[model samples]
Target: MTGIRAALARRWPTIVIFMLLGPVLFMLFDMAFEQMSQDPGLTLARLGNWIAEDVFFVPRFVFMLGALPAAVVGALVAWRDSRGLASGRWIGGLSAGFGIVIGIFFARNLFIFTPPPLGAQLAIGARAFVSVVLAGFLCYGLSRPFARPLLSQEER
Candidate 1:
């Protein structure tokens, strides 16, 4: 508990900044993806509706259940990155965290309101887990270049 607390205390500013910005980024990405994909089927209202219907909806909810684990992973990455000028681990971790953040936000919308058969809940859970893991791995793979420079001692 203390270790996490300390990490939070040290990293809180960065974490909170990213956390708060997450929704804005989400909206931007959502809109951008919609536009780029030219998905006429999606609208802001429909998007909101999907968000409402999916995941475990809580009123006035900001944080999704997956955010907790995601943030932990992100912090770990960021901490590792902080060790040098650029840490791939940090980007990888943060990217994973961001993926989870985005994933949970969407997943919450998907499963939140639907009447569940136990199987459906299990399915959603499995999908959500896969999405989070994939996001992390993708981020890690993509971050190697960016993180490499930072991780190098020359930068320090």
Candidate 2:
């Protein structure tokens, strides 16, 4: 469709960045999974013991390595969209962060078998949601200084 093509044309840089980074992100996740699978029993034992302390590491890594870079790329795209005057940085960052988190959830579901118990699953889901939201907010805060209102263009 023309509409889709137009949108892609307008946002090609962001799309290209995502496309380039996606495989690397997936590979990192696969490596993490492979490491866990290699010693499932020991990993499980360690996880059980450290659930309260380190259970958030994976989500944090996803936010930092996966979402943050994507958000920065998106912010750059937004800056370009604003004709180099305003960034719209928070909007881009939040959208990218949320998108990455959703993608991660979907990928986990698709690739991972042997589901954990319901309670554990629920806890993990909740943690991921919270972590993503927090990361989004952090990105928003970090971006605010760079972003300007689009309406300012007309005012100038």
* Weakest lDDT window of 10 consecutive positions for candidate 1: 142-151
Once fitted onto the true fold, the runs of candidate 1 whose alpha carbons sit more than 4 angstroms away are: 1-14, 21-44, 50-69, 85-115, 134-156
Cα shift from native, residue 145, model 2 (Å): 0.9
Could you tell me every candidate's TM-score relative to the true structure? Answer: 0.39, 0.38
Query: Each candidate's lDDT (Cα)?
Result: 0.48, 0.48
lDDT of 2 by residue, 22-136 (tens): 4334433333443454556336455445434654465345435655555455545544554544444545565456655654574456334687676655544544444444444
- lDDT value, residue 50 of candidate 2: 47
User: In model 2, what are the clashing residue pairs, if there are any?
Assistant: none
TM-score of 2: 0.38
lDDT at position 64, candidate 2? 54
